[model samples]
Target chain A: MKLEIELIYKQYVDYIYGFIYGMVQNKAVAEDLLQDTFVKVMKSDIDKIENMKAWLITVARNTVYDHWRREKRKLNLMPFIRRKRRDIDLKLDIERGIEKLSPKLKEVIILREINQLNYKEIADILDVEIGTVKSRLNRARKELRDSLEG
Target chain B: MNCSKIEELLSPYIDGELSRDEIIRVERHILECKNCEELLKDFQLIKEKVRGIEIPQPSLRIKKKIIGYARPRNYFLRIIFSTSLLTGLGALLVLTLGHQPYIAEEKPKEYYIMKEERTPYMEILYETEGDYILTNYEGGSL
Candidate 1:
């Protein structure tokens, strides 16, 4: 069991971490989600997962969405308070542009670009059609380019 | 292929996801259409920038924590092994002290206070057991 986990960790840790970090954009939260993702993997029946990388990414994405949903609920209960915005860093323009994208587009971009997954792999991870993945990737790039330029 | 269709294909072309026929068609269209060419460049730039964003690695501590959590039996064994080692050491210490009344001294606990200004949305303050206070302000508090 230990060897199995070590092997899986060696193979997928960085990819899973990158995917979660892209989704959450917070180091601490991303690390927590990464931990949660691995724990889920450890608990799951490994023999059943035919595509390990895609399965891991799917789990990571779901963990991120679960975190977001929990945060949204907490925000709903909290009193509204206005806060000052920090100056945007020029170096982070592209990242911020990605952050500005809609969730669907942002996810496709992350899976494709950051994680370097192919369209078919991304489709498998996202449970979407390959055509949908292509369109989303195209739309995501266009939106990101426009945001950076504007 | 028209410019709009070619534009849509630009991302796939950059990703090397296009088939032989589609790639030939998009390349032919891009060579003639300046707008599509520029759009292709923009897509390539976006891909580069997204790929360039540094992905932070999860810390070793987090990795150990996850592993420990996943395999609680191993962790429990570790705890037991360490405790046993400590107990054996303590037993040796007592055996060597033989009738020399040993007085245990309590050391004063040291406290560290930290204040961090993060973004601007949320402020959190907490106190440690040793009277150390930490105040943290973070932006985009959910």
Candidate 2:
């Protein structure tokens, strides 16, 4: 069991962090909450868990929500210079274009492109139907293309 | 299908979610039609751009920090958990042993007196064998 946790942590911690960072956009906050999410999973009875990856993602999502609830009164705790410069020009442009999208569409794009999640997984994460995920992702991609082309 | 219907299916087509038959129909329609072909190109451009967007490799520091945070030995939570555990144990100990429920360890009896001049003494008027005692002196009453 201990080995399992260590292995899972080693394999997925960075991926989970990147996935969440893409959403939250603040590394420090994402880091703290990522830890909180793992702590939550560790404390939970692991025997009941069937899908560790999905379960971890759900925990991470819930932790983000809880963090927002606790810190809602604090205004914009994100540091200004913390936004790292993009490594690739085109990728950065696409990322910036994604940032310009509405939150709903942006989430779909991030989940699909950045996270590389399937449409069904995106639908599950967003708690929407698969059709909704398809539509939102399509709209997000269309918006990005138009922005870049123009 | 009409142009709008074909356009609506283009996104799913690009994703390859359509059936093989549907793919043939769409391909044939786009091959002959200028407007549908243009729409297909636009969708294709979007897909290419999305696929081209590089996965920004996180720094060693970022990885360290994330792993550090995600580890079980979380700083704040550990402190809170230990402190609460200690407090609960202490409270349990006090409840179970300090204030013995079965023994009836009487609280120290408090005596009040109004003094006029001297320090009044407690005079035992009657005495029992083991523990009980009575006091009757007027000075003791005062």
Candidate 3:
């Protein structure tokens, strides 16, 4: 059991932590949640999880939501960032622009671009159809562009 | 297809996720529609930029901690230590109450004060005790 858990942690620590920190955007919070996530994985029946990446993602995402709920602070407020375009060519405040996005839209964007998960993988993580992933990304990009354009 | 229809496919088009038929349709439409051409440009550019911002990697310390979860430890020792500690404390409290017949007369006010002061701590103790009971029931030391 010890070797099994260590192997899984060694293999996916980077991948899991990146996804968590990408969502939270905080190093300290991410670190705590990373430990919590691993604790959960250790306690669970690890051999039963066929798709480790997806399962880990689902657990991490819920852990983040649970943290937010405990704090009573969701990512509703546009965090304070300068309204400078993130793109060299476009006029979007990349950080502010993403914060402006609805959480659902922002999630799909993060899963796709930051995690580099394809639509199918994202679909599995979000528990939505593949078509929903495509549409959400479409809306998210459009909103991101419109936020910049205006 | 009109620009709206083409716009829906543009994101997938950039990702090469569209069906061949949808791909042909989006490509043909974007060629003629300047608005959609720009939209596709923005989607691709934004996707690239979002990917550009570095994700926070696990610190070496955090990775070590996570790996430590997999390490074997004597949780049974923890269970025994805590159980014994609580049991000893409970026994001491009961013995003190039994010996102090005079203090027992003043118990109502003291009980109220202690309840007010110690409710939160007692709740925590109760939760821990509940976990211990469950752990024993499950035949696991965790």
Best by TM-score: 1
The residue-by-residue lDDT of candidate 2 on B75-125, one tens digit each, is 797799799999999999988886765646777665444332111011212
Give the range where candidate 2 chain B is weakest over 10 consecutive residues by summed lDDT.
B116-125
lDDT at position A36, candidate 1: 79
DockQ of each: 0.40, 0.08, 0.25
Clashing pairs in 3: A85-A92
Q: After the best TM-score superposition of candidate 1, give how far the Cα of residue B128 lies from its true spot, in angstroms.
A: 9.8
Candidate 1 lDDT tens digits, A64-101: 88877776665577646333344234338888888788
Interface RMSD of each: 3.3, 20.9, 9.0
Model 2 clashing residue pairs (backbone) = A35-B69, A35-B70
Question: Which is the leading candidate under DockQ?
Answer: 1
User: If ranked by lDDT, best first, what sequence of candidates would result?
Assistant: 1, 3, 2
Candidate 2, residues A1-150, lDDT tens digits: the string is: 445566777888766776666656554556656667766866788778887766777787778667655544332442222323332232356666765788678667666666677877877777799888878867877798778776
C-alpha displacement of A109 in model 3, angstroms?
1.0
Candidate 3, residues A4-62: lDDT per residue as tens digits?
77787778877888777766665666788888888888888877899989999899888
